[model samples]
Target: MQDMIFDNNQVLAVGSEPFLSRFDLNGKILSRMPCAPQSAFSVSLHPSGVTAIGGYGGLVDVISQVRSHYCTFRCSRT
Candidate 1:
């Protein structure tokens, strides 16, 4: 799951699957992505309307407020 700060009201949760999941303004799930398996982990949201998602083996994906995307260095410990 990915945590997103939308419209400054509450947090929005989007699934890690390739498809998109829908949620109401009240943070209720109106719909969900079709059952697709994807490797995803914890999610953190910033006040700047950015989202950070950690994936398996410690890969981090970042989504910017401008709708751009980036990936950060991965760190892991066994």
Candidate 2:
């Protein structure tokens, strides 16, 4: 897994296909979801029940209430 965050007695991890997953303390996967096309590198939870996954190519996936939205940014190298 590339990144993980613990909340509400569950573990949220981001990685390969099924990029975002939630696991119980016993390591059983409770739920899984796709994030970005590229590998996810970070995961964060919001107080408002929103989830954000950051990945390559300046892509970020935001999930709220079972709905997903992708945001992108352009980066320039000097």
Which one is best on TM-score?
Answer: 2
Candidate 1 ranges with C-alpha deviation above 4 Å: 1-11, 14-22, 26-37
lDDT of 2 by residue, 1-78 (tens): 889998799999987654788899999999888766478888889988788888777677788745455454444467
In angstroms, the error of model 2 at 28 is: 0.4
lDDT of 1 by residue, 1-78 (tens): 654434454444545664224466766775443222254545566888676666555666676665456545477786
Root-mean-square deviation of Cα positions for candidate 2 versus the true structure, in angstroms:
2.5
Clashing pairs in 2: none
Please give the lDDT score for candidate 2.
0.77
How many clashes does the backbone of model 2 have?
0
lDDT of 2 at 10: 92
Model 1: clashing residue pairs? none
